[model samples]
Target: MRRGIGLAAVLVIGCGGGSEPGGIVPLSEEPAYAVVLSDYTSTAIAMVRADGTAVDERWVTSGTETPGLVAALSGDVAIPSAGLGDGTLWLLDRFRTDVLTRIEVPSGEVLGQVRTHDAGEGESGWSSNPHDVALIADDLAWISRFEPNLDPAAPELERGNDLYAIDPSTMTRRGMRIGLSQYDVEVAGADGTSATAFARPSSIVRLGDVLVVGLARLTVAFDGAGPGAIAEVTIATGETRLIELEGLHDCARVVPAGERAIVGCAGFGDMAGKRATAGIAVVELVDGHVEITRTLRFGDDEQLPVASQGVVHVDADRVLAFEWGAFDPATPDRLFEIDLATGSAVEIASSAGPFELGSPLFDGAEDLALVPDASRGLRRFVRGEDGTWSEMDAIELATDLALPVRHIARL
Candidate 1:
């Protein structure tokens, strides 16, 4: 049986007509929508029109004992379709907990939840660290687990570093598993313990019948990473192939860009080494084969200084990305409008401090982009009549929790 909690219904006026008790509520009558925001520990959702107007900030909140949506300890909001609208949402309660909670939008109801991994002895015994989900249909979905089990006697379902097929509606596994252990590399820990590094699958994006998964390939001790790779899994047959990027490490974010996909690779190692290996890879499916057509490397004199914390494709030739500035305290993180064709970038906005910005969400219909910042709230950027993007005033949540915005998904 599925586990869930019941919460009081909160009415949202003016967006659409009211629904009967326990019925599906229409979020909006138009294409205008809302975004669900997470702060690792909790979440808050808000509605915004196509014109960039904030409709409601407290449509749903994690302020009560049994909140409609919850992120246990350290977790994130996982929506199958980040750029597109989907009424379904998944909460990944990672860290010490290996649970995946399914939520219904508008109603803010917890439909059901499932433990993604097996529990051993104590609290820190084991965790699969479920990262991202790719929904193929109403009953079919795939979740990528980031941590690999070191125990040689672990069960197949308990093994991490792979994708597990599940039914989204029931929040249960469908008895099929796609393992990526073939991509593991050897590494040593700080205690000098040598073990095979995990593929550490993070983000997943669906392209036709194939699912493109990004592998972080971090060491056993989590202190370093190897050359990142992309695993292409055939949805119908469960066949898989790994494509390793020569210089990139920790390529964990993948976004759809027209016929191609943009991968954000945060390189590994010390400060200088991280910058040298960090870059972006533009990939596309050609003749049934996944190929990396272009790459934009950081650390070069002309390239961007650091790796990207978030990236969103604006068009076929351009992408909006924010740099990771934690390596250097003197440099604040900046959002850039990068030109893929020319290998050039234009600074559009900057954060107050390092590591404040999170993955961005863009609505082409609204021509609006949202970047979540820990200190600045939710930042908005709008494209003007002259085709130039400009920053607008940030949207502040009315909640008193003081949680930083970590992840966002369009409603």
Candidate 2:
């Protein structure tokens, strides 16, 4: 049975919609579209009003609630149990602020039931980790699964080649594995600890006619991943081509800029266990093959970064990316805008560390990008009239409403 709370039916509980302003939808209004928060440490999926304040502590679900990742489909949210290895997809209605359906994914958890927050602990059996869900249409989608038992010392554990086609209506795998190509990565040991590890997939993007996938298999615990590969998947035929990249680790943030895919790559120093600088891989797909047209590296002066996430395409050539190094107070995170034509990357904004950087969300008009900083609050980057991206005012999240949100899952 599907479980959900109706939005319009909550007026009596003071949880109903709020008043209007300027004949415009008030920021206080029962969230025209609420911001869903998945705090893994807190073990809950909470919500903040549309204005980025106003916390609803009770608006959470029960279970072994580790909010790994989420995808916004139209107005609904798709949250998979990547961290939990649960074979379920929680489909929540953003407007109603409730889960309307629970769809299963390939190799989903055997505990097939709607889970509650206070549910007792149980021995959920072994299963493949469901990494991400990419919807191609209303009832069809592609889900990437991770192979289990990734041994850090064993370099062979880094090879990941799992992608599946599924029908949402039935929660079933539609065909055989859409094979992923393997890339060899060499990891070096810094001290007694071996840096060698397995390469795994990180992010996925859809280009003009192909789906771009990021694979970084050799990831040593906490030290970060080894050199990665970006694969181009044909949507119509489910055919995939694995294009290996050099000096590139995790391209968590990949965006489509016109004819090419702007991939933010971390350099070789990451494999040595030190916080290293990052580079940009400017790639274009031709005849279903991945080609690296050019690679842009930061000068020696810009050496305090590792990898990037929440990469967004601003205009025709300008793309925004957030850089991550170590995340301590001494190490500040960076935001950059890359010029595709010149391969020039300019630092746009920097944030004090000890805080987590949430995924980036762009306004419907694509004029503004919003990222939540768990330690401070929320930060906004706007597309300037001059074609450059400029920092806008950032508001701190209400410390009392919810725990420092790990990531603002969806806007």
Residues 260-350, candidate 2: write the lDDT tens digits.
7777665444325322435567677767566888765553324423335656556666666666636333666677766656656677677
How much does candidate 2 score in TM-score?
A: 0.64
Over the stretch 1-411, how does candidate 1's per-residue lDDT look in tens digits? 233444344423222112233443445533244455566655555556664455655454444223332333233545443443456546565656667766565454567666676565532466787888887877787889888877777877777789977776666667777888988987766566776778888888777778889888888677767677888998989899988888878888887877778888888878787788888889899888688999888866445656466778887777888876765546678888888778788887888888788777777777788887788777899987776888888877544556566656655
TM-score of each: 0.85, 0.64
**Alpha-carbon deviation at 213 in model 1, angstroms:** 0.2
Question: How many angstroms is residue 304 displaced in model 1 relative to the true structure, after the best TM-score fit?
Answer: 2.7
Candidate 2 segments whose C-alpha is farther than 4 A from its true place: 1-38, 43-127, 137-139, 147-161, 173-175, 184-197, 219-225, 258-260, 268-277, 299-307, 325-329, 343-346, 364-366, 387-401, 408-411
Cα lDDT, model 2, residue 367: 77
What root-mean-square deviation over C-alphas does model 1 reach? 5.1
Off by over 4 Å in 1: 1-40, 47-56, 63-86, 120-124, 188-195, 300-303
Model 2 — which ten-residue stretch has the worst lDDT? 110-119
